[model samples]
Target: MATLEELRKQLDTIDDQIVHLYEERMRVCEAVGEYKVQSGKKVYDQTREKAKLADVASKVSGEFNKKGVQELYEQLMSMSRKLQYRQLVQAGALGRLPFIEVDSLEKETARVVFQGTEGAYGQAAMKHYFGENCNCFHVHTFRDAMEAIEDGAADYAVLPIENSSAGSVVEMYDLLEEFENYIVGETIIPITHTLSGLPGAKLTDLKKIYSKGIALMQASHFLDEHADWQKISVVNTAVAAKKVLEENDPTQAAVCSAYAAQVYGLEVLADHINNEKDNYTRFIIVTNQKIFLKKATKISICFELPHESGSLYRILSHFIYNDLNMSRIESRPMEGKSWEYRFFVDFEGNLANPAVKNAIRGLREEARNLKILGNY
Candidate 1:
């Protein structure tokens, strides 16, 4: 065997040759892009790329090298496709997107809808986003809000999408697929749960607690202290507070926001009771129209991947090659497809950006049923 320094020198020399070959390969890819641009052909030639992967894998010696070479060629081909997409964009060959771009979202006069009753966190998020005095109504469930927007009963809907501590609101992701609503914006609100009861009720007076199921879970630490208290789940935290006030039961209290307690005429017996002090929930502003603002900087998209080895990795390479920053990803079971999933990804890039266009172009070709949920 060669000494360590001798092996390092040989590896460096091979790497230098690889670098030169990479540049030459990219130059050839540019020519291919030009030909496709003039011929009106798609950048992703699936048939050709599949053959190339198989050919490269066969040329390698062992099983490990075969898999490694295939993976390497997959990335190279993805980079070539992205380069082709960029060339198309530069030549004005990239077609218009399905979504319409608007200068701004209608805020002042637009009617808005949110789930839950007065003093709900959803209500607070809606108010903060659309302005405090914005015209808005309340519904009983998140699904109802989606329906309201779909039926044109409301111009917009505000619903929670995720929580920092508890993770994603899975129902929201499902609703996005079921409804035609598009997310135009989002807001984050700090969630500080309080244990409240009718005026003058003390913690020791409490025999039971009522709140949204998630709220009760979040305040588990505080509730664990009084394990004997019967914890009941309700539709909304505000609804729980309303029920406590309506019942006028001294032994009953609610886990809700301080605003909710105040709105329902309840005394906040305990404040900041949630296990996670810095807990926050992200809410999305959804509208019926498929429109995004001109300066929107983030996009939400969903796609189902084929059931094949390295499929997910190959699809994600488009984002990596284009230098797109993916902020979040969530997988939901695909309906009627057992053991398969559709992925929802949130990434940072405007629709008008060329790099974004390049990535989406490649992703759409490779991903099954790809949908751009919104760019905002």
Candidate 2:
């Protein structure tokens, strides 16, 4: 056998040749991209890729080598497609995104809507985003708030999307998919829960507690101490305080914000009762118009992948190839499809960025029903 040094030199020579051939292949692929661009052809050709993979596998030796070559070619083909997408963008053939870029939201004359009654967290978020004196109204349900924007009854709607200690507001995610309204902005508010009741009521007099479901969960540690107290879920925490005040029953108390208790004319029996002291909730401002602010730095999108192994990985690779940073991802069950899910992803990129366009274009070709939920 040859010495170890000689064997290493042989492998290095082969590697150098491989790199040279790879570069030659990429040059050919670039020419193909130019040809397709002029011919008005799409970048992704699934049939051609499948045939090429089969041919590459046939040229390899063992089963493992065949699989390895297939995987390698898959990545190479993916890179070629991405290069073509970038070329399309350079040629201005990628087309304009549907969302219009605006200097800023029309906060002065815009009518905003929120879910639940006054003094609710949604109201707080609305005030923080649109301004305290902005023209706004309350709706009974989240769906109603979405409809208010969809039907043009309101220019925008404020809704809670996620909470820090608890998790995502699931209903809000569903409503986002169901409606055409797009998120324009977001705000984070610190959540401080309090146990409040009638003016003279005491903690010992509490028999039942009322608050939003997620609010009750957030205050689980405090509620666990009062195991005998029945926890009731309502539409909103502020509404719960209003309920406690209207009932006039010392046995009923509410888990709500201190401001809400004061708004509903109730007295706080215990303050800062939430499990997490530094809890915060993120709220999104949505509008019917397909527009995004010029300074927006985040984009949210949803897509369904084919129920096949590596499908999701392939879809996500576009983000990696484009060097886009994905901030968050959540999956929801696709309605009427058992075990199939729709993925929602939040990434750090504006609508006008070429990388964003390339990644989105690749995802649109590979994934099903890819929707740009918002760019904010």
Taking the tens digit of each residue's C-alpha lDDT, what string does model 1 give over 1-376? 9999999999999999999999999999999999999999888878998899899988979999999998888878878888888898889886898789899998999999999999999999998899999999999888999999999999999999999999999999999988888999999999999999998898887898999999999999999999889999999899999999999998999999998998999998999999999999999999989899998999999999988888898888888888999999999998899989999999999898889888887888788988888888
Q: Which stretches of candidate 2 lie over 4 Å from their true place?
A: 1-6
Worst 10 residues of 1 by lDDT: 357-366
Candidate 2 residue-wise lDDT, 166-189, digit = tens: 889888878888899899999999
Give TM-scores for every candidate, taking all chains together and pairing residue i with residue i: 0.94, 0.97
Off by over 4 Å in 1: none
Consecutive 10-residue window with the lowest summed lDDT within model 2? 85-94
Clashes (N, CA, C under 3 Å) per candidate? 0, 0
The clash tally of candidate 1 reads 0
Q: Residue 64 lDDT in model 2?
A: 100
